[model samples]
Target: MEIRWLEAFVVVAEELHFGRAAQRLHVAQSPLSQTIRRLEASIGADLFERNTRSVSLTPAGRALLPKAYRVIQDLALATDAARTASGAVHGTVRIGFSGAFNHLTLPVLARSIRRELPEIDLQLVSRVRTGDGVAKLRNGTLDLAFVGLPLVADDIDSRLIARTRLGAVVPIDHPLADAPSLVARQLADDDFLSMPVDGSSAMTEALLRCCIAAGFRPRITQEVTDPYIMLTLVAAGLGVTIAAEDLASIMPRGARWIPLDDAPLFMLHGIGWMADEQSSALRAVLRLSEAILPTPPD
Candidate 1:
């Protein structure tokens, strides 16, 4: 079968709607339907169960998906390899980054890459959450990601790039705003807010344990991914939250940051890439990142 056929099939599988998949592929619905029908005929089985209101993948389609994904990823990697063999570092390395990485880590890394490896192209994606970054890296959509560390996964590799302590963000008018620093337990009674604490990183579990030690379990009032949004929610008198110290510069208009006194309760920021990544551009960035990101303090 043609690669386009495979591409069309994958898109349809992902979307589960012919019109939506066609829109994603930048084609009309009729031809996309025709292609899937032709693909099904060639493979001698129905890939999708379709009706007026819904579409679902058949067992055959489900079984073929991961293998097809691998075929596409391998083909792309081979193409990138061929480009690298042409004697110059060319091709884009898609790097997924989140809040603080976009505001802080990215600038330093970008300047270094531009100055030292101008031939390499960088596609920087911002606003990615930790879980989404992990998924993207695994699916070959992102070459690498700047993510929270303490990730133990069989499909990905991570290494520490920077370290930061978690701190409190409260509205400036709040009673505790003037406090210089705080022990983790002190915030237990406060209505807290934070990113999803789903074991995607060590911070979530650590935060819970810290609060429990502080004599009360935290009542999480909100779950947010954006630093500014967390601060914004605080500024609006919604709740108090915790965030990395590196993001202090962009604290929302009415919020104040108080350093946390817990020494070992810090976020370990790191680079996560697919275990089998072989991109020349990704390698160059990883090398530069080692020098750009500071060594963890003893």
Candidate 2:
């Protein structure tokens, strides 16, 4: 019936003792009991089982506890946003990005968010996979995500912000390194260095499709997930791998990245946020991102 009632019910459910729950709520035990009784009556269900030796939630109470906790948490976040001093917007905006190519957007985003939204704190996570970003975004832990394309979740708005072309990473001394570019079939005979076949990075799919179009499945020799590590393996001559072209800037050592010349393969990149996001802090970050990283033409 009231926030206080839900609070009392939740505490009592947790403590499973009238005296303890009352003490935690800073109220007399009788009032706390009455509050739970009133809530149970309003819902027409027995919320708790009590006896001389023990107390515990009934099925209804157990079911309501998590929903009640979420209601309280959502209210607290809304209150904090509404009551922030001087109204400059104070809160942490968590952003998730997968793959080394994210190096392209994250630095500029961090600087922009700090300069533009001084009261907001930036929490950046190197989410190594798209599934990681999806899970965090849906759970409300991440406010924004730099996700690779082909995301199909209904609740996420995967707004295309940039595009990275698929390219091959090979030892600089490898024969293919001297060419401006080569067809996918040229590397068909060579062992491929790639992210694990797990569906984490979009490049994994793009590279596979490119090779398939070239009439062969890539002979994967290494299945490292991190882009930097895959490139390192490439440099060591373990095998050639597929990755975004921009990621070449991240590794200063032995790899020469060359794009597929005959059939260009590209990975579309985007920023993802919960489709219903209304947080001011999140909106500000999105605005800043749009200004700095507008999706390239077409």
- TM-scores for all candidates: the values are 0.87, 0.74
RMSD of each: 2.6, 7.9
Model 2 agreement with the true structure over 139-163: per-residue lDDT tens digits: 5557788878879899888778877
lDDT of model 1, residue 193: 78
Q: List, residue by residue over 1-298, the lDDT tens digit for candidate 1.
A: 8878988998999899999999999999999999999989999999999999999999999988877777887877788789889977766788888765357777888889889889888788887766778988887778888877777677898878778777878888878899998877777678987767775534455567666666677898777776567678988888887777776888878888888877556777877898876678788788888889765765
Model 1: runs farther than 4 Å from truth?
110-121, 201-203, 213-215
* Candidate 2 stretches greater than 4 Å from native: 1-73, 84-86
CA lDDT, every model vs. true structure: 0.79, 0.80
Write down the worst ten-residue block by lDDT for model 2. Answer: 79-88
Q: In angstroms, give how far residue 77 of model 2 lies from its true place.
A: 3.6
For candidate 2, list the clashing residue pairs, or say none: none
- What's the lDDT for residue 25 in model 1? 95
Question: Best-fitting candidate, measured by lDDT?
Answer: 2
Backbone collisions counted per model: 1, 0
